[model samples]
Target: MRTWNDSLKIGIPLLDCQHEQLLDQMDQLLEAMESQKGEQELRAIMGFLKMYINNHFNYEESCMALYKCPVACNNKDAHAKFLITLQDINHKIELKQSLELIVTQVKQELLDWFVNHIKSIDTRLQSYVKKSE
Candidate 1:
């Protein structure tokens, strides 16, 4: 249900685009759940997430490194934590835990984290990049 808004833009085109893609994927997963889709659809979303997140984080980290951003370490640490949380969610799903609960957790946690990251970490990166340019 989380949609990208202009307020979320970090003033970096590439990073903003990547962030939008992630939000789109998250929206798709949320829609699938709302539509009462089966596990297969959820699994598909998760599969896409695993690959997309890895690529996005790597690219972001590279950008941070290129600019020598002070927050690079913290950003990477946050990324690792998110990956772990995602894996734990997957494991819970596999264990046949409450689907609704899991979905709610994903909605709350991921959305919260994404928005906060963009505002706090990515915005700082954007400023650094702009200043460098």
Candidate 2:
């Protein structure tokens, strides 16, 4: 099930809202997979993933730069890599490749990256926002 757990909240309401939305879409995709749904369902997943990442990535990078984060560039690079991998995964799905392995990998990678990135990297950005307020 998709969740907006307290652990995922980054002390920024707007960002947290975005994260909740992204997770919801992800959960929908997972549910579709569990139901043996096919490529049509994956279309929405791909679209949501693309849109969410585009918008959220910008917000994150802007926040990082605005905060003069020491790791802003590194964080941006990591996000870019994630976007690329997400695209590749979608491509593989489109090619009628076995999604089971890809889905499993994506879930683990995304969850780990999301939690760590927000808690460590984003917390630094949040710290700046807090100090400025």
Candidate 3:
């Protein structure tokens, strides 16, 4: 239900773009679920999500490293936690859990986590990078 907006922007163009793409992907996943697509479709979306997360996290971490952001470690830790949570959800899906339940959990957990991460961790990293500049 969440859409990418200016409020989510961290003042970093690449990261912001990646965030938008991520939101778009999440929307697609939700749509697929709503349309009652099979487990294969859901798995495909999950694969894409994993790849996107890896790329985005790497990019963000590199930026943090480049700028010597103090919050880099915390950011990495948050990313790790998210990855673990996502994997657990995927495992549950693999176990033939109800699609509705999986979808709801994904929507709630991911949307909430992403919003908080962007607001807190990413904003701080952006501010630090901008200050360095």
Backbone clashes under 3 angstroms, per model:
0, 0, 0
lDDT values of the candidates?
Answer: 0.86, 0.77, 0.86
Best by TM-score: 1
| Residue 96 displacement (Å), model 1 | 2.9
Q: Pull out the clashing pairs in model 1.
A: none
Per-residue lDDT, model 1, residue 1, is: 50
- Per-residue error for 12 in candidate 1, Å, reads 1.2
Estimate the TM-score of every prediction: 0.93, 0.90, 0.91
lDDT per residue (tens digit) for residues 35-93 in model 3: 88888988998899999999999999999989988899999999999999889887987
* Ranked candidates (lDDT, high to low): 3, 1, 2
Cα-based lDDT at residue 11, candidate 2: 86
In model 3, which runs have C-alpha deviations exceeding 4 angstroms? none
lDDT of 1 at 81: 92
Error of 2 at 30 (Å): 2.0
Question: lDDT per residue, candidate 2, 102-127, as tens digits?
Answer: 66856776655666777777766677
Off by over 4 Å in 2: none
RMSD list, candidates in order: 1.3, 1.5, 1.4
